[model samples]
Target: MSYPTISFSGGSIDRADYIRTDPAKLEELKDWRARLVKLDGLDPVLTPQNELEWGSLADCPPGADLVFLGLRDGRACFAAVPEAGDAGALQMGSRARAAMGILGHDDLGIYGMARSLVDWHARHRFCAQCGAPTQLAKGGWQRDCGACKAQHFPRVDPVTIMLVEHGGNLLLGRQPRFPAGFYSALAGFVEPGETIEGAVAREVLEEAGVTVRDVSYVASQPWPFPSQLMVGCHAFANETELTVDRTELEDARWFSRAEVVDALTGAQGAAFTPPPPQAIAHQLLKWWLQR
Candidate 1:
């Protein structure tokens, strides 16, 4: 099936690797014409119209670390890492979800990049190798440790999120922190040296004690809650029996396609609240239904 336009996947900006690698090119873009994506500490700053707000470098306080967020329509873009000692927004998670809901797919993609890079720089201020302070390099793409000559870069952890299907029904589960009656596809981080398919199988078995096979890739999304690549997939459950791990999920059950349709469409008396549109879990369910 042709993939849908997943959230955080369709930015029009050109990530100028050339400028990042070349000091001269990077410097040229730091002029007044360059634009900056404003941030409230670690959170995004939106306009009154719910659009991504832009500012000039003049708005950035002196000595703030500016991360180059590539070129938007040939104009350089940047985001300032929140200054040190600034407290994080108390409602950061909810505010970010609200932004994702109102933002266009392209704008969401841009915010994803900016948030991840800015947060990475803020957290990685020191070299892991030598415990020495590091300096921004490669237009904020890399951190250089002068003491040990070590290089650090932003990382995106990969997570496998799958919809397990069997006998024309879809398997779904709810976590403890999720809203009451809310359920979504099961997901877990892909451990080191594990293939995507292998991870899917392993996660399904561990979380719900259901062995899955025929694991196949679907669409993917960039989830920038600290930078993660959500790998969506479809897998076939060999058996319907479930041994739910209570620690990971409050409950696990197989739901008919009709129930899923009701949950997704918000029909009255739906079985459970479906995952939000911005979530890869929601996309996975849509893909399964479309197929």
Candidate 2:
């Protein structure tokens, strides 16, 4: 079966380590044809025209916390933190939301990497081992504590988002925060010591009170809204009746194949809608539709 190209999933960049331990390698940064990705807090700095806003290392303002992301087509790629107050022609907003609209597929992939790394750098400024301030190391892929000599790396939280099916219907649910009339595949963070299949089954039972079996992996996407690896799956529901936990979901229901097709295509007269194409849930639903 053919799969749609997921956003933020393709790039041919190589994360070179020549600059990782060698501070000297950073000096040649200005000599390369590099792409710059700037972040302010959790958002990326965008041009007035709404592009990713790339510039030279020399153009970065003073006090920009910079990290070499790697090589794109043999050219250096870097991410920098433009001093908050000096963001002259750039503006900041939700990276997750902005990425989908402003970036191309490959650029979106690079943005995801940058977003996750910068978030780690910002959040881990202080070391947990000895309570000392940590400094960037290994070309921004790691942090080193000066006090106790501990190192920290960026973390990717694993989340299970599964489409549960039984008979000729698929299961979907809605949370209060979701837009009106929209429903999505059930999802939750994978807990410690749990397998992906185990997590999928557990989450399905917990949220909708539907026991699931034959869990199968479908695909994964690097969701960089503060760093999550969404592990998409397809599962078979053992029963159809739902006992939705109100605290977890507002509603959970099974939709037949025809109903799902209408929702996926945004057909008029549809009672509910699936998530957008940018989300993994929408991909899962699309996969189901093709089947």
Candidate 2 residue-wise lDDT, 11-117, digit = tens = 66787776677777765764747767665555766777665667777766577677788887777878874333212211234454756876677777777788777
Candidate 1, lDDT over the whole model: 0.88
List where candidate 1 sits over 4 angstroms from the true fold.
84-92
Winning model by lDDT: 1
Model 1 per-residue lDDT tens digits across residues 5-61: 788886878888888999888888999999998888766789998889999999997
The top-ranked prediction according to TM-score is 1
Could you tell me which 10 consecutive residues in candidate 2 have the lowest summed lDDT?
Answer: 83-92
Candidate 1 root-mean-square deviation in Å: 2.0
Q: Against the hidden reference, what TM-scores do the models get? A: 0.96, 0.90
